[model samples]
Target: MCRLMVYLGDPIVVADLVTRPSHSVMKQSFAARERLTGGPGYIPLSINADGCGIGWYAREVERKDGDVTPGIYTSISPAWNDVNLERITPKIVSPLIFAHVRAAMVGTPVVQMKCHPFSIGRYMWMHNGEIGGFSALRLPLLNALRPEVAQKCPCFESDTAVAFAVFLNQLDDPMVQLAPTALAPLMAATIATIRHVAVQNGRGDETSMLNFVVSDGRTVVAARYTNATDEPASLHYATGSAFRRKKEASADFRLEYHDKRSRLGLVASEPLTDEVADWAQVPPNHMVVLMHSEGSFVDTLVLPIDCESPEVQDHVTRCFRALDQSIADNAPQALQQAPGGIPRALKRPSFATGEDVPVATAPETIFEETGQSVLSVAADGTRVFSGSPAGTIHVFDLQTGKLLHTLDDHSHAVFSLAVADGRLFSSSMRVVNEWDLTSPDGAARARPRLLSTRHHSDGDVLALAAAKGVVIGGPRDVSIHVEKACADGVTQNSEATVGEQKGELVRARALLTDALTGGHVSTVYAVVVRGRWLFSAAGDAAVKIWDLDAGKHKASLYGHAGAVMALADVQKQPSSGPDADAQKERSNGSDAATSPSDGQEERSDAPDGGFWLLSGGRDNSVRVWDTDTRECVRVLKGHADDVLALCGGFGGRFYSASADGTIRAWSTATWSCTQIFHHEDTVPLAIWPTERGVGSGAADGKVRSWLVDRK
Candidate 1:
């Protein structure tokens, strides 16, 4: 067994993958965490000291027409002890890289030629597992390869080399660039062919771990498979917007997803970093394909593979024979049928031509409170809840735009509203009211009966967030109040207050307060609860992160030039495939709010499903911050005035309402403004994202819904 890694994304120095990480491929050479033991042909040695190799495509600036083949370097020395590798890797940078550290199979020689990654024409390949009883099947495997592929094969005495030959034999022209869709199936077919040969030679019962990775400069496909039941060699992958070494001298690395689209993709036999959440195990019998999309973002796809299937077995046999005959007959069209049942490559709509930009039509008045300015808006799956300055909460059907109920709860203006746990929470001066959406009484259900009202001793309640029986209220003052629902139908108040008291930061299990000497220094404008962490946007131009469990200040993110007025959490979405739906459902069902700007839903706090915080600032820009890294990855500046409200996680898009009288829809994939809904002479105060459009509360005393065509 060996350690191998593949990187397909932004250009990075070779050391980033091979040498620098805490558990990099080089480190895995000696201290692998998940390599199989006691398997057929498996050596008991813990160290992969046989050899080391790396292959990388030339940087764009150095690439010429026919000279784009990758550069390869191999040495018959332990990767850690390779002085030449250490000296040269830091100086080499490439966008696509394949690296491996070998612990050669029982009979394999420790020669430079034996070290992966093997290259033929424009492709590079690396293997992490051994083929059981390969010595008996070598001649048969070579004989099965097409004559042209056999002529070009390097004849290296390695199972990986034989597998590479089989892979090339399936390609009509090994030198021609193939799409990831084409490459993925051919890779699957290669595994099937190897299995067929193993079964033919009576080695079917023996374990054959075929963890392989192949790349054609622009596209990459990696497989984790084993003929035996035990698990395939520990293959894992991670995707994010940026992959960075935490500190200059530290081996720790971080993969941050600033938004939905992934800018980096990594596949490895062992995790490169100690951050457990950063890596996801690739299923035993599956392949992961990384390819560049037309939108210029990397797309990752995980596909299941069944080597035992008769259809797959026959497909591999016929694919190669058909390819060889096609080459002889000079019939390129026959190559179309060569790749069978492989999922077609995803062709995402290109954002370059503005085709994906949403079209915002005229706003349809959902409800008009005659003379009261709409102050807050929140939404669930079917209803739009709008709060007014008159303390009246109006519920409207999302589909019909008809008023469902009007409840008078507070004596003061309603500034914020939130929906969570089948309840609606509305906040006003010195009090927060909770209404039961699932109330048993039919009459009370339509007009959700006010369950409880907690009086705040501080200033006006400016923002509200509720989840898991706890309600957090951000006040006009620099303090945050926590209210817990008691089993006895009462409310328990625990104020986490932060203020200028004695210029010292206060800490408590429930009370939270930032000192004027250090923290917020102004009113808390918005509060969002995600898991055990509470995020508060304040008038001090900063967003502070609080650990709810500890009730202590964790970190403060600062980038806004002026006061941060509105805050929303845009839950990160899976880039592609079946997992996207599962991940989306998980995000929607958990702490992450479906409509973040509504200040109502509990946004997903699944630590692994990272989130981006969108803060609308008085600086007239909306900044996107990666909560994990606490870094502002993007600052969207299109609003001519201060951005007042923000909402995201609606069909790969986010919307921002500005005091400039416009609500702008942004594509989360591109981070570009796609559509703008103008409110004429009024400032849109709050926005909530819906399935088909966005609902807004504006200064013009109207609750409106705008149809956003995102298709």
Candidate 2:
């Protein structure tokens, strides 16, 4: 029950799609001719007489010069009896390539690191189904990775190559430590951490088959899951086109389209040729992206799962009572004339009255695991620090979601999670530890100390923040250091050589010479620092405004069309006595970093501290923004797909996730969308909140725990 393929646009040759495709994947390993069986159809079968494994990669050039990177190769022989894969499949070439091909199924074994493009540096991975209960969740999911991803996972065993080393130890930036536009949250948290360890061993009703293919040789995410929502399997997708082969002798390749470089893309679980309109189909269980040069699509069922459908739970209880009456009818008539506040409109003007208070009932499902996802959620609101996708980090309690400590110390997935003071930070790619969790009991032999490690010679820690100390971010390392507070071990930090600060690096060479004199697109991704000001979000859709005590370059802002992911601030909580020293004597009587002229309107009786961001895109809508008026005020819409990940939290509240299996929350003073949640057959590649109220991580490898009660 497996077959996969993913080949990015242009630059070909990994044997032009695995040993000259005419049905290649090395001729479907001795004749697979595209398998997909299901009774009355799908007959062309062949597991290549039971032995065949291949995993190519190309894009070299490093014999010294500079930029070129990618070069991997894995083989268990049988790519038609490799003669060095027929002398290196027409001599390597790549834009981004991943070639799978194997046919072993049932418990599978064949060795050579269990083949299939599974690499770790410059990240390359491949998979094609069969994870139904993996030996009943293989020892609590291999005791949840992170002993260097269970000793670099691949005991010559095979659960699709130990589920890509449990997705490189549940990734927090490990495509060999990143690049390729941060690889779609590590291929959506490695297919939700192997469907949450095959539904914790019970095999969650069998039928698993997740077809995957990832790449860091420059972005390429390919997935085709199936937990059944109307039976999914036999995948097929071809974008724009271009496969060719049959001019006469026919082994079967033929697709070709082009239409003047709309660019080509292809994903397959079946259909290597016979272009029925250049091969469509891909709908079962979703996910298919070919980003950058565009040309590829797939993701739509329009959200709603977790077993509902009573008319989608009465349209999500009327979209949560129209978002609590649109924030109590958009309050903000000067906060209902100050005083003791409480005009009772339900605190809405983008929300600020005891924020995100839902809990009328339902919620108690303690740590269920099953294709887990919950990427981040560090809490102080009573202790909650999640992080999953199988690199593991559990630690619950939020008034009893129970399970206090799990921590498998990341091998891959667990992307960023922070929690000040009593400690608890986490990360994945180029490491980042630091846990103490003031533990009242929660203990997995509680150890985690390593205060610093940074590294990122090319990129890894994709995003993390702890304010007043550790920052981390990604895409070839975006800076923001400080950490020294609680300290523990791994303290490396020192690599600016190449002529140390060639003149404070001339402002990154004047921002790459203003991106070639004005074609800018920023690319930072996301960074946040509060007190000394630092806010970012790039891909050039613009949003910077740094100052980090003048490391230079401030003011950038611009708007967003896509790219920028998440950031938050929204003020009003800094009171600790003297009626908070009487609001710091009314903000030292006003004016602090001014800037509100243009037809004026900047009132703050000392409290608007400001900050709202939300972002999320590829255009499936989340929007928000308002950092003191850089605009974009509201957009919300009901996620049917794209939005990919976001957090915001506590009281001006926000959550999002998308590619649409749903995770929602919203309420920035009522841009609406109150609950939603769902998650059913998975898609959400990350969602957070730990001191307990939310935690989601999907792609179907399950890691759910929601208790958020504010009533």
Candidate 3:
């Protein structure tokens, strides 16, 4: 018996979904709630008695500042006992995740590499059930793998893992790669290859549990089928928005089927969750596929035959002809559909050259220049939140550059700043302090209250902000810590506090601890909080999405030219059409499509309500990407120096701060520069929107308040 979980949605932390969930994969190894083989009598369950394994892949993120190769992790130990699980779960995030737990059906090997979810280069394959004639047909199947693939087979004797290698090898064959007009045909060839050797080796009419899964680190394909009469195993698939929603309303979240945004199609022998509506049974002898397109399901028939029978020769020949026909019939349709299974092509962005406009206008005069170096700026419309490298926090008038009040509350450089709930939170080199910054003069000589203290271990604190919660990102500790407003108000000294509540706060406390620390090789650069998720960019050249409530990673977004320095969520249009039928056919997770077994009405894809994410990098350009579609909507390039910070306004206005000592504004639609405000002595480090308007903080210890026409 084997258990598997496939998650497609926002990148989530492996621990929150795979390890810590009520019915987590970790628990499934010993105490699986639902068994595919009827009841749990067939296989004994116990965390200590049963062996477990997990396999996962991370996405390759491209940033303007850097790029990262995708990462994969596999384990053989019981997930709960493995210290590494706790170590790496929060640190790594991916949008598309696959996890599996094993309860060996037949061939139980002591070695770890023999586990399912096998990998060949970027491709990973796993099988839930076993082939009925594996023992008798092993030799024939092993021989079917090309010599190259056979060579990669396990030294240890596990049938499932070995079978996976064979499948991967066959997939790499030139024939399958070049001629896959339809995946069904290629899959048919694989099945034929397996049957050929089984009979030649004198195998029997074995009933095989062929619930198969494979992914090339991008597209994932899973199938459930058996040669038995009744049904292979209990397999289920669920799709819709509710399956992907968070488990909690707070930032601390869990996986719950709330909305239908999450379209999950699971092909398990038995349903993982008890929600009957959340699971659907995969019909006998049929294959379900999850690709970019929603309608990727296809049914194929493979008649079972006895090995060593006179019909063997006929079976082989028939198999070849059937495979050829299936492949030919499926090729044209698959090719016509573009990447991500969407039939329609994405629109190319329009760009303009400076030569087209000989005389570009300068920024309109708004706020009188404040002669202070701004380290970070966030404004609404009536009030401004500004911080300086000199450790000064200020609140000023957006309409006029009148200095509200200067407070010397911090002791180190304020590299980043954010304002929310009428309070201003600023992060220095080693500490996080909050100012009762509702009014302009709130910072005047007023000592800021300390909410939390984090020891600096990496290097420096680069970014910080406060919203529904407090978020801090920097080079050394690159972790996010949230202190609810109720957690405020402790004036006790550090020694007394640590001794008193260390035991209670140690458990179930969502605060950032030593475990959230970054790996020595990587640095966290910036973090942006939106609803229940936290998006972080790192020195590793990746942008990771974390689910705050669950305190785990959701997904990792890649596709940038450099290390992501800034992340901002803006608005955008729907890339697909309005017809309900057409939209349902399109794929959502990564670039794979899913087709339903029962022919049903199609869904439409029109512009729905969603925001676009803008990330700036050392690559010296800004990319606007649709969060829902995960497609790059636009790319704007004009910065002279590295773009260090970015902020988008509520009125379609966007602003960026750079090493070139200037804050530039852009029209989100045309992506054209609207204004360029040059700083003489101050170098803009970070920028954000405040209650009053847009504000820019600089390296020269000055915070500038800017007023823009919102029309």
Give each model's whole-structure lDDT.
0.69, 0.49, 0.50
TM-score of each: 0.52, 0.29, 0.41
What ranges in model 3 sit over 4 Å off? Answer: 1-372, 380-382, 438-459, 470-472, 486-521, 573-609, 678-682, 690-693, 699-702, 705-711
Runs in model 1 lying further than 4 Å from the true structure: 38-45, 307-419, 422-711
**Preferred candidate (TM-score higher): 1 or 3:** 1
Q: Order the candidates by lDDT, highest first — what do you get?
A: 1, 3, 2
Over 353-382, each residue of candidate 1 has an lDDT whose tens digit, in order, gives 234444443776556454666778898777
Pairwise TM-score winner, candidates 2 and 3:
3
Error of 1 at 8 (Å): 0.5
Residue 544 in model 1: lDDT:
74
- Model 1, position 467: C-alpha lDDT score: 78
Candidate 3 achieves a global lDDT of: 0.50
After superposition on all C-alphas, the RMSD of every candidate to the true structure, in Å, is: 19.7, 25.5, 18.1
For model 2, the run of ten residues with the poorest summed lDDT: 505-514
Count clashing residue pairs per candidate.
15, 46, 91
